[model samples]
Target: MAEAGEGRYEIASVISRSFETVRSNLGLFAGLALILSGVPAFALNLWQTSFGVNLNAAQPDFSALLSAAYLGPLFVGWLVAMVTNAVLQASLTRATVTHLSGEKPVFAQCLTVGVSMILPMIGIGILLALGVGLAMLLLIVPGIILWLCWSVVVPVYVQEKVGVIEAFGRSMALTEGSRWRIFLTMLLVLVGLWLLSIPVGLLTVAVAATGSVIAVSLVTAIVSALGSMVMVTVQSCVYVELRNVKEGVAPADLEAIFA
Candidate 1:
């Protein structure tokens, strides 16, 4: 275990490590993000845009959007996207953990772990969303607190093979003394992403105005995929840092869990 005051988790360190991991594994991470998130997002955007819904108009055609033709495909696409996202999260978590352990991440191994853990991850996601949503309905502060407390649940489950409730508890324990730092780290990362999206958002609007569905979809997909890649990597790094600071567990030690 970490000795008292021996290891302090630094926000800058986690952010730096996250960027370094993504930079070093750019091809692998990009490929996973494109295939798992980009493609589906593109398909959905293309389908929606093809319907010619002028969302920018003073009054949009809600009736057309409510039609079965629009809602059916959209519902299916949303479901598919959700599953693929779960897989992506697991894959990225595995890759990040392996990379941090001083080993090269194998694409096939990462994919296999992702597929194997999809169902459990999806269940956990639903539970998390419901809990947080309910909390938010009560008070925004409680929701934020719950979110910060459970921020690393996915990583805890992926690395430890724990039950759902156990994973939540573990995350709460890991973040007990560092929730404030965790909140700040995530807030900064989110703000950075939002700033990065501004130009792309403007481009997307311009492209949409030109009635070019394909171009708009492409831009949106790439942006979404890149954002997902960075966020997942950051989350994984946070989990690793938390473990190091709280338990004195090194990344190489985490590798033994897979062994």
Candidate 2:
């Protein structure tokens, strides 16, 4: 934990501290995940089950899936997911900041932080998504490069309270010499998440076999929420480590932002 706020972090220490954060504050992380991801995921899953449609299918049977009945719930679920994701990111950023500063994060206080930053956070997220999507449209490599380059934008925006444009610049600056490290960090996190999902995937399959939509939805939602929480924790840690190493930003400086 001490290493998390110090001079430099190897990839291993960053990951270790992230897990420690989650372990030490399981209730806070779980509650945030439930509010931000579990409910929306469950709602979406339930809606899809009720509609008897898979909006996520590679080759969806549009004849039935394109109807008003299907589109209505689909749109609602999408909106819910989008809004909740924005909230989750903001909440996680705030909570992680507070935790790293060695303070107990109050749920309401964290929520307030999230609410305050939701607009700018969501705006930047949308812009980044559009930028990545456009790059992907042009070429796959460019999209991946852009994603890596802008990886720390969210944490920068939250911690620095910069505008979206400045946040992008700040992220690029912090990630300058460490883009490869960030890539490896992302890769490791993804691999870990995939491994974590295996058990949940099996559970989903088993539940699906029973033809109980609610059960399947509930299990899937829980798994998705857990994954989201872990990823956010790791991401926040990565941002802090990067700032510490790149700009010599002390932990006290970080805490002072909130103070």
Candidate 3:
């Protein structure tokens, strides 16, 4: 029990440091999150006949719709999510450098990181899904462990400027110091988002009763998009802190290269 408690404290400390970096560059997350979500939300609306109708509606064609919806941009949200982190991290590295060394980074520089990270971002999505699936298969704990390991891979990619496997290696290396701590931190973020969304969801449903379920869904998607933004923001910040502590590279050095 004492050892576990100590472990939690260490994880919290690491996360606190990480959040400091995130706090510095919170703005970059907004446009990326919204764009990523907007593309898919728009796509779903475009394909309204089969996939747009609510599953809970009285005459829903659930199975066929579900199968069709599986391959769309909605699935791509995870990929966009990973890329958003890559972008957000690059922004943070810039902000960190500016804050630490008075060097400002331009917006175009940030877009470059986000654009280049496309493949690895998609790869991370596949890997995360596999990890979670395997965990569910093996009674849950192992899956959560893989989740914690892979969670920080994006930051590793942007901050460390490594390839996909190397990013995974870096994330795995950091997880070595405290898996349970990472797990709990992740769990809290996820659960907190779900709980907060409950009210927004209810409001959407209430509005939908009068008309326009699509609008309600868009509003809900925006809420979820914000949640995604917050999640990646926190994760990206945590990445910077972990890297600073691990590699002894000042944030300015990273900014000089990434920014």
Model 2 steric clash pairs:
none
List residue ranges in candidate 1 displaced over 4 A: 1-6
User: Stretches of candidate 2 above 4 Å error?
Assistant: 1-9, 54-61
What is the Cα root-mean-square deviation between model 2 and the actual structure? 3.8
**Per model, how many backbone clashes are there?**
0, 0, 3
Give the TM-score (vs. native) of candidate 3: 0.73
lDDT of each: 0.91, 0.83, 0.61
Model 3 C-alpha lDDT per residue in residues 57-165, reported as the tens digit of each score: 8987667556735556555655555555545445544344344434444456656756666666667666767777978798877777777777778677766677878
lDDT, model 3, position 13: 56
Best by the lDDT measure: 1
Residue range 1-259, candidate 1, lDDT tens digits: 3347757879998999999999989999999999999999999989987888888899999998899999999999999998999999999999999999999998899989999999999998898999999999999999999998899999989989999899999998998888888889999999999998998889888987997779989999999999999999999999999998888898889988646
Q: Candidate 3 — which pairs collide?
A: 18-237, 18-238, 135-143
Which window of ten consecutive residues has the lowest lDDT sum in model 2? 1-10
